[model samples]
Every structure is written in C-alpha cells, then in structure tokens.
Target: MSNVIFTSSATAKNGRDGHVKSDDGLIDLKLVNPANNQVAKGSNPEQLFAAAYSACFDGALNLVASQQHKKIDSETNAEVSFCKDPEDDGFKIAVTLNIEIQGVNPEDAQQLAEDAHQACPYSKATRGNIDVKLNPKAV
Candidate 1:
C-alpha cells in the first residue's frame, strides 16, 4: 500500500451466526445465515459485500465520467451470490452489477460502466477471483 489513504477494520465473532462490530462502532450487529431459515436480525456477509461493492462501483462510475469530461447520473446495484463451487466442492461468490445511467445513451452508459469497472478498486480486487457480470442501462 503506497501512502495509505485510510484503513477500516472490523471484528467478527463466530462464523455465520455471531456478532460483528466495527472499530468505529458504527456497525454492531448480529449475523445470521439466510439459508438457515432463521429470521435475520442483522445481516450476512453477502449483504455487506453487496453494500460495499455497490457504493464503490457507483463512485467509480462518477469518477470515470468526470475524467471523460461527461456528467452522468448513475446508480449501481450489486448482487452478490454465494454458491457451491463445482471445481473444489467448496463455496464461491459471484457478483452482478446492474448499473443505470441517466442522460446518456445505452451504448455510452455501457461504455461508462465498463470503464468504471476497470477503475473500481473492488472490481480490481475481485478480478479473476470471482465471476462478475455487468449490466448497464440508460434510463
């Protein structure tokens, strides 16, 4: 890490059915696996990842548009899925980012989304490690 911008940390107790709290005390919640048929009192890892990825991708979209000297209104929704890995008999995750960009044509919106994906930190981190699908639409 060059010239560290900022770092955030959190602690998780127990695997899927425990508690998690952030160092800033902003996130303190119970964890529950939605697949276990339990009422979710807090949230699962997938939800957290989705939240982070969506926000990051949206920011990346704006940044890319700004660099191109274009103004665009964009929304990014990340769908993270936990699935069984057929290759390893383990579990893996995948992501689908549905992006909506206003004030641009469909092709341009998609180009913006693709450019954003190339710029997003989350997308860079998950590249080649997980399957990511991008769906961009103009609205």
Candidate 2:
C-alpha cells in the first residue's frame, strides 16, 4: 500500500440502476442494467469496464514495447461479458482483449500481448478471479 502511486475513487448509488460519479466530477452518468430491457440513457458497468480495461491494456502494451526497444502502433479492444456462473448459479464476468499491432509479425504481436498481460494492472487484478483471453494480431 505504501508503494501506491495513484488511486481512483467513484461512488455509485443504488444497484446498477442509479448514478455513478467520480471524485473528480469528470464522470457522471446514469446507470442501467442491460439485461433488464431498460433503455440505456447513459452507460452500463460492462461498458465502463471495457473502456477502462482497453485503455489500461493499451498503455501496458506501449510500456512493454518501449521496454523491448520496439516501436509499435497498437490498438486494444476489451470485451467484457457478464454471464451466469454455472458452478454456483451466480454471475461472473469474462474479458477478451483483441489487440492489433502494426508492422509486427503475428507471433511477435502475440508475445508482446502475453507479456503485457503480465504487466497490466487490470490483468493482474483479474488473473485468477475472472477469465481473460488475449487475442493479438498483426495489422
């Protein structure tokens, strides 16, 4: 905890059907449950998670490439899915990060992605709790 460099805080009212706002007041949005047949006026938790994960993964990819002394043009798309947990009859989430690196071979790109997955904070946090699949391709 002492080595923490940054922290983010947000408050959510109600369960998936109220409002969420960051401490900085930069993100204030209405929340909706996509499975409830509700018209989404703002955003959902899955969408928010996807955005955060994709951005974080992209940054991790850049850091890995820089460490390897390789110039990479990369894009990361995170797809987060909320589904029923068959084992416990509860709910669980899964992520698939579709990554593309320009001017790199498929194998190299995949390797970079694997390395980045080990480096990304999000990936590390969800390593054993949730399933994450990495799909990297050269573009």
Candidate 3:
C-alpha cells in the first residue's frame, strides 16, 4: 500500500475547550461552539467542510478555465450546511456555491461551473447524499 500524510494540531482558546492533533503533530486547529456568537470561530466540521468545498470548487473552476484558455476574474463563495440526520443521528451536509466571473460569456461560464462541480473533491465525496447547488454568474 501507498502512504500519504499531513499534520494538524489545535489548542483550546476562548472558543472551544478541547483541541485536536494530527499524526505528524504540526499544524494547529480547534473546534469551537458558536452558541451565543453569530458566526462560528476556531474550527468546526462544517467550517472545515466549507473551506474544503470552496477551495476545491475554485480550484476546479480554475483548472477548467485554464484548460479552455479563458480569463476569469471574480470570486467564488461556497456555503456548506451541516445538520444531524433525524433517522440515524448522523451528520449530513448541504452546499451552495456562488461563482462570479467577469469577462466570460454566460454559456461558457456555466459550462465551466458544470465541469468544476464534477471535479470538486468534496462534491464527489458527498454525491447522492447531500444537496449541492452551483450558481455561476458572469459579471
């Protein structure tokens, strides 16, 4: 078998009490409870998923655009929602991606978005289990 590895470490601060450490024990990360706060701080599963999905989608879009020789300058936003499954008490996620790319035709932008959605790692991982919506706009 082949092996690939990375490391993450976390410490409790004002947000969450406990921290998580990776195998190699390098990078630090934490999970915080956003109970009274409006936004989630520290690190949580949803935040991690959101970060992963957003970055993956953006990378996928960039790959598609580069392959098609298109120039796009804008932002991509991904919102990932996680909730407990009522039946099994498991977690489920829902993602909504909004992409704004300037100087590209709407059709081409849409095509790139389609390709990105197909290529995104998080989308591929959560296929058929969660709801993922992609909205691409040309600005």
Q: How many backbone clashes does candidate 1 have?
A: 0
> Model 1, 70: alpha-carbon shift in Å?
1.1
Q: TM-score of each candidate?
A: 0.96, 0.96, 0.73
lDDT of residue 134 for candidate 1: 99
lDDT of 2: 0.93
CA lDDT of each candidate? 0.93, 0.93, 0.75
lDDT string, candidate 1, 1-139, tens digits: 5799899999999978988899999999889988794665779999999999999999999999999988889899999999999999999999999999998899899899999999999999999999999999999
Q: Write the per-residue lDDT of candidate 3 for residues 14-105, one digit (tens) a residue.
A: 54434655555664676675543556556665676677678878988888888889888757888877667887988677788999888798
Give residue 114's lDDT in candidate 3 (0 to 100).
91
Rank all candidate structures by their TM-score, best first, as comma-separated numbers: 1, 2, 3
